[model samples]
Target: MKLKMYFLLLALGALTLAFQSCDDDDNDGISVPAELQNALAEKHGNAQRIEWETKGTYYVADFYEDNYEKEAWFTKDGVWQMTETDIPGLAALPAVVKSAFESGRYASWHVDDIDKLERKDVETVYVIEVEQGKQEMDLYYSESGIFIKEVADTDGGHNSEGYLPSDLSAAVRTFINENYPDARIVEMDVEKEMTEVDIIHENKAKELLFTPDGTWVSTSWDVRTSDLPGAVTAAVQARYPDYVIDDADYVETKENDYYWVEAERGEEEVHVKVTAEGVIL
Candidate 1:
């Protein structure tokens, strides 16, 4: 009986050890859904050392591809949202993208960080984080070197006063001075996908848009509905008779000049672009 009891105690000890070993093999009690695993495999066949975690409504996968760390986010339903890859250095960026940043408006800012964002159905974007003094900003660029947009760092609470005259590039300054010599620049915003300058010329407010390289895109100014061109007024009256002409603007682009008119009837509103000759565009 004594020998039997001893063997029973040893068996119990072995069973407890086995249970502990199995628990250790489980990934912190987190089971990756089979759907998510399948999605990750389909998207990143070369991914290695993958680790998974749940963040908010997204399932995040951290892995390495080509020996570089990468992160991919997927929706709960296994739809790939985006992937971010760390760029080792500026040298790793495409030539056009690198050149654009070197010659762009924020060239003097110190580069803080860089990342490449690849979305499911959108063009890849390169993000460059830069800083000057207390002002930090994120500049986004396309693969072909087109400046996409600028976003100020929210943590710094930087209230942009708009670009000052000194901040304007020579080309931009020359264009404004030659075109609107007597105009005073009221404000300048470098956000969106282009630089916009607000000016007051001859007691009228006008906004000018420019590419990052200082090429002119368009100029626009508000116009009273009654002040709209006869052709524009007639066009709107004929097409949207029940809608009241509430607002209008005269816009001049390199290609052509047109009037943008807004018509509203209750909650239903329509915006129409009509040329000076009354043709709707």
Candidate 2:
């Protein structure tokens, strides 16, 4: 969706930590069960990768390759907690993810992102959304690694248009705009069949799915100051429940930024501060 906001002509950046491993660090012991390890390796060994992280007292499983990545979370006691490439909450991960990663179906594919999807009530599902060029392939999976669904251009991928699958995150879009403002976005199309568009300029930057009618969508504008991502949005809303938006503006070439929201309740007046991340009460 195109995010509309006041443009102020300033720059803002939000930093989130990501795991880095230039060389596979197989030196660590398995935090996951031996059975689980064997199962994943046996199936996903082709482009299959395994990484671990700690979220609170639990452990998280991260799978990745050249163009995609997926996350599966678990407790130290071998109980599955939840999974998502974005949205930092412990919720049910779709069975399709576990199955696909467990089946080695994407073992040879290097994915740039593992898009996390969700419903109004259910926990988010993991989808291997690979951006090939002008085309995108949304590869769905089951928790046990079964291929559930694959959607792409119906014209046998002959069109130059591309789609954005449901799994995209605010971070992905914000990052692109903040880092690659010069990238040309030719269109913005989101409808019932799919959310696809054409981007003509990226200086050889790989398209999410370069194929015609690429099934990948592009979020092509700056985000509103009030429409930040999950954690930042939550933090601000919780921290500044009383503040009212006096004025909101985004400096051009960036998402939300340097905006003022004034709050006055029963004679107490104060200005709530919001950084690129969230409200700083």
Scored by TM-score, the top model is 1
Candidate 2 per-residue lDDT, tens place, 69-164, comes to 655554466554343444222133455454445465444444534545422212233466554556566665433443434556345432211222
Model 1 over residues 23-83: C-alpha lDDT tens digits? 6654343458989989999999998878887777778888889877888888888988777
Error of 1 at 35 (Å): 1.1
* Poorest lDDT segment (10 consecutive residues) of candidate 1: 157-166
* Candidate 1 positional error at 2, Å: 23
Q: TM-score for every candidate vs. truth?
A: 0.49, 0.23
114: Cα error in model 2, Å:
9.6
Report, for all candidates in order, the number of backbone clashes: 0, 55
